[model samples]
Every structure is written in C-alpha cells, then in structure tokens.
Target chain A: MLNIGQHISQEYNDELEDLRNQVLSMGGLVEQQFSDASNALLNGTINIAQRVTELDYQVNAMEVAIDEGCAQIIAKRQPTAIDLRNIFTVIKVVTDLERMGDESEKIAKFASELSADTNSMGFYKNLKHMTFIAKKMLTDALDCYARLDAKKALEVSNMDAEIDAEFEILNRLLSTYLLEDTKNIESILKVTWCARSIERVGDHAKNICEYIVYVVYGKDIRHVIDGKLQDDK
Target chain B: MNNNKVELDQQLSETVGKPLINGTPKITCRDVNVFYNQDSQAIFDVNVDLAKNQILAMIGPSGCGKSTLLRCLNRMNDTIDGCSITGKISLDGEDIYSNDIDPVLLRAKVGMVFQKPNPFPKSIYDNVAYGPRLHGIATNNSELDDVVEESLIKAGLWKETKDRLNKPGTGLSGGQQQRLCIARTIAVRPDVILMDEPTSALDPIATATIEELMHELKSSYTIAVVTHSMQQAARISDRCSYFHLGRLVEVNDTNIVFTNPEHELTENYITGRFG
Candidate 1:
C-alpha cells in the first residue's frame, strides 16, 4: 500500500493503525446503513428504515471522534509527506461517510413514506437496480481504502457515471409516472427523493474513492474523470 | 572559466528533483564526492545549486555526509588527515579547491557557524571585530567600532549587548553567544554563510530567534544550513536537499520537500519511516 504501520515509534504505528481501522469501521457502518435503507425502500420494510434512521447518531458520533483524533495526532506528531496525506485523507473520508449516513437516513425517511403505495411496485424495481450498482460502488471504494489501491479506487470512481445515468433514467421514469396520474403525485415525489438520496450516496462513495487515490498516490483526481482532467469551464 | 571536466563516474549523479535551478546559483557543486580514507567514502556524486540570497537546508540521518558536504564548502575538512574531495565546487564560478585560491582567504569569503556557539574568549565587541581586524577591513579604531556595532545590529544582538561591549562573549546566554558568533561571521562581509546545525544546542526560543535571523540574513548573503531537524529545515530554508547514505537523493523547494517530495527516499525520511 503506502508503507504505513512501520513507524520507528511503536506507539505512532499503533495510533496510525488504529486511525485506519477506525475509518474502515466507520465505512462499514455507513455501508450497512445505506444497504439497510435501500432494502427498506425496495421491500417496504419500516423496521429496517427506522433502524437506519436511529443508527445515524452513531455515525455522527464516530465522525466527531475521528475528527478529534486527527486533530490530536496533528498537534502531537506534526506529520509530513505521506503520513500527512493519510491523516488529511482520513479527515475527508470521515466527512463523506457522515454525509453518506445522512443521505441514508433521508432515504430511510422516504422509504417509510412510500411503503404504503402498492401501485408503485415498478418504481421500486428500477430503484432496486440503481441501488445494486450504488451499493457495489460503495463496497469497492471501501475495499480500495482498506487495501490502499489507487488504481482500484480510480475504477470505483468511474462507476459513479453508471449511478448518474441510472438516476437520469429514474428521473425520466418518475416524470412519466407523474404525468400518468395526478392522484399519485405525492408518492411519486417521495420515490424521486429516494432515488436522489441513492444518487447522492453514490456521489459520496465516489468522493471516498477519490480520497483513497489521493492518499495512496498523492494525486488529487477529484476533477478528473476516465483519465481526463475536467476543464474549469 | 578553467576546465576541470566533471566526469560521470556513477549513477548517483542522477539526483532526483530540481537540483539545478533556473536562477543563477551563487554556489554550485557538480558531481562532488568526499572520501575519509582509502576504503571509506562519505559523500557521493552530489550535483546541486545554492541560489543567491536563499537558504538551502541539507538534511539526512547521522553520517549521511550532510556535514561533510557543508565542511567542503569552506574547505573545513582540510584540517583532517587523509580527507579528500573530488569534482568541482564553485563559488561564483571560481573553483574553491583550486591551488591559487587560499583556503584561509576562501573561508573569509564564506564564513561558518557551528552547532555549538564557540565564541572567542574575547569581549563581545572583540569577538565581532576579530575577522575585521585580521583582514584589515577597518582602517581606524572608529571604523572598527562602527563595524562591530553594525555587525551586532545586523545579527540582532545590538539591543542586548550594546551595554556589554567589554564583557566576554561567553558570558551571554546560549542564544546571544550564537548571535555573537553570527556577528563575527558576518563582520568579514562574507558572500555566503554556511551553518552546520546552528540551532541544535539552543532552546526553542533561541532556535526561533536564529531562524528569524537566517530569514533576514538571506536578503544579503547566500546561506546554506545543515540541520538534523526536518522541521527546522522546513521552517527556515527556501530550498531543501535530502541526503541518504551519502547520496544526494533529492533537492527541491522547501514546500515541495516537506509536503510532496518527488523521490521515495525523501518521502520516507520526511515521513519518519526509517530515519
């Protein structure tokens, strides 16, 4: 990976290892929250939806703890170069994970609202497919982080395009559903919100992947897509 | 310009990063190598430039030859038996090791401050006046006094030591003694000043004072400092060179060296991976 965990100071090594593990644990929690929220939306499961919403506080708490840990390490160690990049990346990843948790909670709240609509079964089918791709992207991004694989992270970053295209198709489909009947406009809007939440989750996952590339390769590929840098225009 | 052709003897001459600057360098080391004995070599093929009016910090682990290279700048290693240097080290396009260039005269042009503040056992005023008097820089007693006062003021020691001109330089605090040494070094009006761990023996406040003084000194003199502390190098230097096992591994801007060094060895050392 980046040749971490071999610091001459054993305590420094342990602290960095702990920080990395904490980020992975936070990533796992975020992934679980997103998965549970997606399942609740697709299967009309209110219990899972309620649990996802409740677990968001834990995510928020983990973010605060990780951020404080980063500050403490920075003050005490004054790290530079790769170690500095690693800590900075962790700080950014924690923020993205917390936002993912928030998005998952939003998805869960919308899941409960759309669960009673038996006429909207086809919309859930489309969301299920989109959720499948988004969830895989999240999982692979976290795997890249755990492995410190910048190439894999770049691959995972590119998968966000799939999510975006799916989002566009779903938006078009929901608009068609809105035109089909004015009576179910409210339920269709809820479904659109859920799709948007899932799309946002994909965006946050892509951000995590970008951060992984930064930490491992020391290259900020945030504005680049498919090996091409985006012009500022 | 005399031709002492720099032959490429080894691959270590390919130092990574921006060792060669676009600006005119006041000092340039082309394929420099230092040897302690027949079997023992201290420095490798180091080619780098020290730009004018800038501080270049050379950093590495113990025995990595940063000090050896710094000593070579003023021919300080000539006192040691069997120590030899090869390749061309030039000061303003003049080869420093040439036979016509006397080492004593060369040192007057390039002064040095050591890790410990070794002020003369003389008075504070005399400590700053020693080089000027030795070089016959001041024509009269009043000129000598003015040189002393001006050197002390430039060294940032005038406010505290103005009243204690007759007192021994050793009687000052650790920081003031180093500043007195700096005043002495600058009294000769050297073109370049070399510092070998000049603040290692001082407290943080003293180190900070010396660092600030170095920052000010760079406006008039080309400065090169060999500091074991990476943070000191990062804080004080405009450019940084990383030495590894006598090889000049990398040389770049201070910000790039501290944050995003191009060489893997530089990154390892900066991140505290091995050394």
Candidate 2:
C-alpha cells in the first residue's frame, strides 16, 4: 500500500519487504495447519493430525524471526510515519496469527484421540460447518491484512458471527448426544473440545481484522464498531 | 501588510496536514520570500509562527535556504549588496521592515549567533560588555559587570570563564567560545535570539550542554534555530519546519514532524531518503 521501493535506501526497503514476506508465509503455514486439522477430524485420520503438530514449529519459528527483524529495523532505520504504524501492526498480527496456529494444534491433538470414532460423531454435521467458517475467516483476514483493506477486514469480522452460531448448535447437539448415551461420553467430550478450539480460532481471526482496521485508517475500531454503527443511527 | 496575502497564502502555504499553532506568536513570518541578485530565489513564500517562549527549528539538507530565512528575522542580510526580501515579518504585531525602524536597533532586539563563535579580539569581559555599552543599557561600570555575570550564567559558561574574565574570548576552546558568543548575545537582553547552526562545530557533550541551555532560555526569550542536524531539531525544538529547495514542505510539532511527517518530501528528508 505504501509507495514501495521509493525509499532512498534500497536495503531498508528490502528489509521491509522481507518482513512482509515472512508474515505472509507465516499466515500461509497457519492456514494449512487449520485446514489439515479440519480434514483430520472429518476423515478420521491420525497421520494428518500428527503432521499438523509437526508444522506448528515452523509457525513459531517465523514469529520469532519476524519479531527480531522488526526490532532490528526499529533500531537501525528508526523508521517513522506510515512505516512506524505498519511495523507495529505487523507485530500485533504475528501474535494473533501464532495463537491461531496454537489453537489449530490443540484441535489436531483432539482429532488424533477421536480419530477412530469421528465417523460416529453426533455433531459432525455442525462441527464441519463451524470449521469451514473459521478457516474461511482466517483466509480472508490474512487477505485483508495483505491488501490493507479495511472494508474487507470488516467483512471478515462479520463472518465470525456465523462461526459462533454454528459452534452453539454443535454445543447443543453434543449435550443431547451425551445425555442419550453414557458409553460414547469420552469421544463426545473430545469432539466438543475440538468445536470450542475452532470457535476460538475464529475469534483470533476477528482480532486480526480489528488490527487491520487500525493500521489502515489510524482508527481503533475494535470493541466499538458495533456501538459506532448504533450511534450512526 | 501585503494587500494580496490571502492570494499568496493559497499559492505558497503547505502544512503538516493539520494545524500546529500554539500559544501567542512572538515572531510571525507570513508569505516571506528571499532572492539574490534579483534572479535566483533562495526562499519562496514561507509562512511560520514562533510561539512565545517556544523554540522553533528550521531544518533541511544543505542549501535549502534555512539560513537565508533566519537572517531575515534580524535583517542580517541587509548588509549583502544584491539581496531583497518581500512579505511581512512582524515582531509582536509591529512590522519589522517598516521604513521608520532602524536595522541597528532591530539587531539588538533580535540578536543573532553565527555558525562559528565570533567573539571579538577584546577580553571576554569586553565581549559581553560590548552590547550593553552600545545600547546604553547600563549607566555605570558595576551595572555592566552585573549584566555580564548574569549573561554568562544564563549561557551556561560562567563557571568555566569567571576566573579568566580578562582573557581574550577567542582563546577559549571551540565549544566554550560558542557559549561565550551566546553569552555576548544575551548581554543585550534581546527579545528574540536567532541562532544559525550554533552547535555545528561542537562535540556531542558540548552540543548537549547548549541544547540544555536552549530549553532553560526558552522561558524568557523566543528562540529560532536553523540546524543541519535533524536529530538536534527533534531534540530541542517545540515545533519544526522542513524546507525543500526554496519552498517550505511541512511545518508541525517536533514529535509529529519526526515520527509522523505528513508530506512525502518531509518524510524523505527526516528518514534519510533525501533527494
């Protein structure tokens, strides 16, 4: 969004580009982790869940590298103006993205434990719907960040309500399934935990969207966009 | 005042993308321009305000006309053969360029310190006493002595030079000599002090000492400085103005100017992307 490559120092410009590229790739890795965790639950596969666990290391490493890179730029270049806002936004987004990956790993662990019984999951229909919304929200949140588009970021935040609704339906169905049978109690509880983990991932995506609004408009629209819309009326 | 200032302001004024005025202005420059030899323009319709008891810094790359505008404040460029100035520069709402105003009296009211310390060959005591004597500020020898001691203390140089008051001012170290020059400027009790690269020749510690003096001095006098060090401007100035070529690109609070400059040219200069 900044008039790129026009800074007098080419190395400074290159370093900024490297930071963006690292953050985007980190987002890419987290997306894959979420997707794989979802498929492992739907298909009753333990190997995909194990792979999700292994890929967590890459996301964590990217966060560390990007944090160090941001500190270096602040120290050496003392970047200011739009550059300062953008760097701070990147720092915040990386934290949110890393936590999103952590949530996906938690889901994968539960998926591995419930792998054999996933076909008989009473709330599988609702669980699939919730994961689909959460994963789509993550993808679109990162896209809004990459483009610095506040409107698209607000759209991603709006989609989170859908994930929350589906999660509620899954919660109700899990309670009904547990009450109907005592033998499947352990597997049903694991599925409920997975659904809650996916719901939290959607929340993290919404948080990322709030930060996008901040960096783009220099306005902190978090916790107040709904109130502002009310006031506008 | 120029009858067409409204039209000129529309053509020449550029800001920080926000208003930055504070307090009451001591020196107000409006649509001011400077030219040499009637052909080459050094400053182009610059407008700025030096709020009372605040330090305003003018900064840019070399040959950006910062010094030209500084000299215009005290009419220092009047000594040049082919230089001319246009637009209104007022001190407390009184136009400084009026025909009835004497440039010599104006210099005492609006004092200047140069890039290098140019203390006289006379004794340090005389260098500080010279201004008081010219304006007849003191009626007796002891009165002049009191003024000299007070000025040296204000310039942060009295402790270093009190014992050697009778020695030549030029004999001091480079930083001390600059401080001595500042002491001389203060001896006259000017309303505004115009500093042109006042700390360029000093070491870092000496620069810091002068900067500290500037903060202490601002409570009493309106100070304006033209500096090549962008960091120094950020450190000492309440407000900062960035000049490019012959035009003022941006003027704003120092924090905003350094951390969040509005114009592309100002951002480029402060961020070392200068073209």
Candidate 3:
C-alpha cells in the first residue's frame, strides 16, 4: 500500500488520505451494486433487480462528489509526482466505476424481463458461471486498488480474458437454444443481453485494475499489448 | 522503508537524470564543488548546463546550496571570506574564473537579481543607466537614454515608469522595484540573467507578472532562477534541477520533474513529503 502520509503538514496528509478513502468507499458501493445485480440475474428476483436500478443514482452521485474532491485537491495542494498520479488515477477509476454501475443496471433490467419464465433458469447455467468469474474479477480489482498492489492488479487484469472466454461459451450455447426452437427467441435474447452486460462489467473491472497500475508505477498501461509495461517486462 | 533509503542513497551518488543538455550550452558547470572553509563543504560535485534561450530553475529546501550555486555563476560568493570553489564554470566557452578574465566584465555578461528588491537609491532612469554608464556601453546622453528605455521596456516596466523616470526607484512597489532591478541588470546587455527568489517578497499578481516577463525574456537570453516555490519553477522553467543536502539529485525537463521525477528525494521535496 502507498504511504501517503508523512507530509510536513498533517492537514495535507489528512486531505490526501481522505481523498483515497473516498475512492475506496465509492468502490465498495459499486462492487455491492454489481454483486446485487448478478444475484438478481441468477435467482430471477424482481425485487433485487429493481433495487439495483434505484441504487445507480447513488453511484452517479458518488462519481460527481469524488470528481469535485479531485478538483479541490488540485486547486489547494498543487500535488506533484506520485501525489499527482494518484489523484489522476482516482478520477479515471471513478468514471469506470460509474460505468460499471450502468452496466450492472442493464443486467438487472434484462434479468427482470427474464424472470417471468422459471424454465429460463436452465438456460442461464452458463451465465451463472460467467457472473461468478466476473464478480471475482471485480473483487480482486478492488482489492488491488485498496492495497496499491501493481502485481495483483496485473493478475486481475489478465483474468478479464477468462470472463471473455466464458461469455463466448455462453453465446454459443444461447445460439444453439435459439436454433433448436424459434418459440423461445424472445427470452433467449434477454439472456444474451444479460450475458453481454456481464461481459461489459468484466471490461470495466479490467479498466479499474489498469488505473491501479498507473497510480503505482506512473505508467499508463492501457492499449498496451499483453499487459506488459516497459520496465515491468 | 529504511532499506529503501539505503537503496536511494546508493542511487543518488550521481545525478539521476540528464543534467547536461545536448548541444552547445550558454553556461556550463562541470564537477563543481563549493567549500566555506577547510572543514565545511557547501556543495558537492554538480554538473549542469543552462541551454541557450531557455530558463533553468534550481529548486530545493532552505540551505540546500541552491542560492550558493546561483551565486557561484556570477562570482557573487567571492565577497564572502574563506569561501572557495573548485570547478570549471564557463560562459560561452570561456572560463569566467581564469586569471585573464576580469570578474567585473564577467558580471556584466552574467547579471543577477536578488531575493529582496535592492534597487539603488537613485532615480529610476539612473538606476537603469548605471550599468550602461559603468560598462561604457553608450557613449552619449541620447544613447544612454535609449539603453535605459529599451531595458525598462524589456523588463515590462516602461509603460508604468516612463512618466516617473526621475522618481526614486526605491519609491516603487515591490514588484515594480524588482522589475527595475531586472532592467538595471539587462541595461548592460547580458547574455544570461540569474534570479535568486526574485518574487519571494511580492504578491501573487506581481509574481504572475514576473513569470510572464520571464517567458518573454527567454527568447533572447538564457535564464537561471533559484526559487523555493515549486509551482513557480513548474510554471516558468524549461528545465529544472533538484538539489538536496549539497548534492545535485536530479535534473530533467520541467514537465518530467513535476509530473514524474526519477529521484526519490526530488519526489519527496516536491510532494511535501520531505523530512
């Protein structure tokens, strides 16, 4: 973890610590929203699905609050070096977290539509597996952010591939279900939409992990091949 | 963390970034060391270059030898008893400390402004004309008037001080006085200007004015500034050097120094993590 304290001014140290804690607090909320949305999809619970949609406004509010905090730090502290990088990373990570909340809400909307037919639960076995992997990826990415562990961040970022592969398998299974009977096309499409939303959640989790690496190493690893940085390699 | 300190010290035995710029520099200091007397050392081996037509800012904590090194550039430290320097400091390929070189003439080429506004107790016009008259730069009164007006204009004080040319320079505001001092330095047409905390005694508006003037001045002369304000360095300098405990810790482009300094000491200082 980064030692952000040791500033000559204790108040400045407190300000930086408060800023980081605010980011973690926002991450916790977003992670809970994702988990709740995943549970609604797996269990076909309308109440939990509606709850996810309502909670998205809170996530959006957190993004705006955290963005204002960053602007305040830049104005008052004039942070440089790692302090500057950390604030910049927090701004980017907050955006990804908010988008993740949006994706989770999409999953909940589709999950609510698919809840009418309990027989559709059998088709979601593959989606259930994908949700498990994606939720774990998000958990690990948040853990990496809290600890400032670049190595673990890289590991979590690589796990996005596993989520992607699971999505592909789920897509193939859904295609077969569609071809076998045209009667279930409408329900199968909802399942496909839920699966796509889960895949997008994994991508957003990967983005958060990349931002952690940026804060620790002061290097932007986005769009880089194989997740290898120049010095890390 | 203690182990990291040991590793950092080992790394800091030499400068961490490119201190010597490529191409012919306006001023160069090679293997420079300063000593106050036989037993005490004020500066370690520092090798840096001031590129032509750019501003180089030297930044560090108080008593870190940034001011000492700035004084060495113009031999301002020569007045201090028992002070000695060992290095090759050259201006335009000629050693300034050589026996054949006159310190008076060298000072004219490498002029300086100080922390406090120390304009002489003469009129504004005379203060600007003092350097030219002393150096015999202008032969007649009209030529001297031209030099004074041009220097004041270059320093961004002509519009404000033109009507009051006969007023005592000491009667102006702190910022204006500093600008008048700058005009006095440039009156002799120096190739380089050294400023030691030139805006330390001024307000924000004044500091902004001087920073803007420095940006304009860089097109014609090389500038080296010693400042305690890291924001000032970030705003005005093209290159920046970080010093710590009498050692040159790092030197790099101003953007790199502020955003991603390579040396830990520089990072700590700039981020307010310094002990």
Candidate 4:
C-alpha cells in the first residue's frame, strides 16, 4: 500500500543530495570565475585572465550536468511541491551562473588586451571599483543561495543600483577622456566595453538574487507588475 | 527521499486504530489487500480517503489491482478463498472487522457498483427497490415507491424511467441500465459508494453522463472509483491513488499526483511506461 508515510529508500535520497551538491559546486565555480576575472583586471595579470577563460569550459560542462541531473530526477523521482521547486531552481540557477561565467570570461579577455597598454587611464580605477562591487554582489548572491536567505537576496538587489551608477559614471568619464585625447580612443573604447560587460555582470547578479528570492520565498519577483515586489507579507 | 520515507512510515504507524469520525475518513483504503498464496500478488494495498463528501479515484493498468482493492472496502474479499487482510480499515470509529460486525450490514453503509451494468435482471422499479426492500429500509409499497423514485432522481434517471417502472431493467439501453444500477446502489443510501470501472462498457455520451452524475452524488456521499482511463480519474476525482504490482506507488491530490507524481513508479505509469 502506498501510504503517505511509507518508507522510501536511502539510495533515492542520496541521489537527490548528490544533485544538490553538484549544483552548489557549479555555483561555487562560477562565483570563483567572477572573482578571478575581477582580480585579473585589478592586478593587470595575463595569467589570471587565461585561467578565467579556461574555467568557462568547466562552467559550460556543469550547466549540461545540472540539466541532465534535473531531467533524471523528474523522470525517476516524480518530485512534488518543494521538491519540484528545488530541482527547478537548480536548472534556472545553472543557466544564470553559466551566463555570468561567460560575462566573466569576456571581462578577463578585455583585461588581457588592456594589460598590454601602459596607459594609466583614470577610468581603470573606476573599473576596478565597479569590478570589486560587482564581484561582491555576485559572491553575496551565491551565499544567499547557499544559506537560502531571502533577506540577503533583497540586499543584493539593492546593491545592483550602485553597480549601475558606477557604469553611468564610467560611461561619462570615458566620453570626457575621448574628447580630451582622441589618440587614446582605442584604449578608452576597450575600457568602455569592459565597463559594459561589468554592468551586464551586475544585471546577472541581480538575476541570481531574484532566483535566490524565489528559492527562499517561493515567489517569482521577475517582471514585477506596477514596479513593486509582490506583497509576500 | 529516505528521510521522507521514514517520516511517512512513522505517520502511517501513528494513524493505526484511529477511528473515522462521523463517516469522515482519516484514511480510506478502497480495495486493499494481503495475499499469501500467489507467486506475485495480484492485489495491491490501495489506499484512498473520501474526505466527507469528496470523490477519490484509483486508476492504473489492467491487473494493477484497482478492482481487487476496491472489493476489500466492505469485506467483499471474504468471499474469495485464500485472501487475507492485515490493514486496519475503519468507518466512523468502528472497525468493520470487529467480531460483532456483519459484512452484509457493512456493505449497506458502503455500497458498490460494477463496471458492467448488473441490474438484478428485474423490473426498472424492482431494481431500484431491491436494496431497500432487502434491508427493509421501507415498510410498505407506497414507502418503497418513494424510495425508488428518490433513488432514481438521485441517480438522475427518474424522469426517463418513471413511465417505464414496470418495464424490465434489461430492456433499457446500455446507458440507462448503468443508471439503473447506480440508482439501486443509491437506494441503499450508502455513506460511501465504491465504483469499479463504472463506465468502461458505456459509450462516450453515457460515460460523460455518469461522470457528471458522480459530481452530483459526491455532494452527499463519499465516492471511490477505480478506472483504467487516467483522464477519467483526473477529471472526476479530487484525490487519486496510483497502484503498481500490488503496491500503491503514490496517492495525493489529483492535480499533483497526475501532473507531478512523487514516486518513480507513479510517474512511469502516468506517462505510459510499463504501467
């Protein structure tokens, strides 16, 4: 008889736990990539940039692994309610983290190219600041997911505004630098592109935070109607 | 999943001997089984709870034990040789297995309808009046007439069969005969009605009528039906149980069990796997 309280096997639970661990490992790797790329930009190191580029493949593989794991769980376990939510969250988080990994690699590539130039661009300082904050936001988003903390996720969303403001400042500073020294336009353009890439990373971090909110609160905050977080209270 | 299984086992153990209050089941097993004779047991332990006035469905492949388990509700399996029951099944604080209890009287409280329309091969009115007359629910012919008309009306076939009360029940079409059978079951005024593949022999229109009738009947009587069609179970049941290989794989709210089953066996069966 299939009673509500009947004993399920340990093998099934272990499999689910293993999948959860795999997703968390993937999240950790993507967060590490984000940090490595930012550190490369800060230190102007080609080796760290090269490492970030190489890790993108691992992130891609993890994405495929997480997708396959979720499919197997849905096929074999027939999870419901909270269990369903957990598998779905893993799927979505892996996708967002993969995109974040891609953006980080782009940042690393931009850093490697800019390392060859000796120009002491003032905008690099602002880029460093942006990268630092963006990396922190990404890290905190991952932490929120690991702890399943909804409040920390909301804090990460608020941090996105600071990254956006930094991007706007970087844009204005680059325009000013271009007009003052037209000969340095190529270098300034690289800086602008890197800034845009960092801005995109910030957006993805916000998306991760939103996903964390979903995991913790079971609410979809994306495309919030009327510019308000739905009244979850 | 292992932890959940242990917790669920604990919950099931805790529920043992808890009586159903006021005909409301804390848990109802329709066609539950315990077999000691077969190489592979044919009947499964099927658990279904008809909460007060709600409808529950037992659906799965042929030989999945949907019908065998349904028959266990009123100790219908006592008639079958070599069948043993170990599970504690109760109705309103009274264990049906108590020594003082009678299977025939228990069946009166929990009536059953079969897949093929078995109308006792009697007249239309007689078929409707059979159960009440046998149980002595009415004292006179006039009281019997009231019981028959009320049962037919409750079965939604009174207007169609009113003028033909004297006609043989076998003369009606397949749909009308099934309704007559339903009216007979209703005449007993059972607290819960057990239906085993109630529409498998009927046409589509007849099936639709029966399904609609079930919705109306559930307002007053708890119902547990076993069907081969997953769609029919999803359509008419508030809750559903999926059985496989003499074991209940899963049971839950119909929407979740159908759309997102929690057991591998249930998902495989629902998605047309090995059934």
- DockQ computed for model 4 against the true two-chain complex using alpha carbons: 0.05
lDDT of 4 by residue, B140-167 (tens): 9999999999999999999998998999
Error of 3 at B145 (Å): 1.7
Report the first chain's TM-score for all candidates: 0.95, 0.91, 0.93, 0.88
Ten residues in a row with the worst lDDT in model 4 chain B?
B11-20
DockQ-based CAPRI category assigned to the predicted complex of candidate 3: medium
The predicted structure with the larger DockQ, 1 or 4, is 1
Best by TM-score: 3
Model 3, A1-233: lDDT tens per residue?
46767888899888888878888887888788888888888875668777777778888998999899889989999999888988898899899889889989988888777778765788677888888888898888888888888888998899888888988888888899899979989988888888898898889889988988877777789988798777672
Which portions of model 2 miss their true places by more than 4 Å?
A: A116-120, A124-127, A157-196, A210-223, A226-233, B1-23
TM-score of 3: 0.95
Per-residue CA lDDT of candidate 2, range B1-275, in tens? 11111222344356544333656688888889999999999999888888888898999888989899999999999999999999999999889999999999999999998998899999999999999999999999999999999999999999999999999999998888998998999999999999999999999988899999999999999999999988799899988988878788788888878765656677667766534
Candidate 4, true inter-chain contacts retained: 0.00
Q: Candidate 3 at residue A171, lDDT?
A: 86
TM-score of each: 0.93, 0.84, 0.95, 0.56
Computed on C-alpha atoms, the DockQ of candidate 3 is 0.59
DockQ-wise, the better of 2 and 4 is 2
User: Of models 2 and 4, which has the larger TM-score?
Assistant: 2
Candidate 4: residue A114 lDDT (0-100) = 83
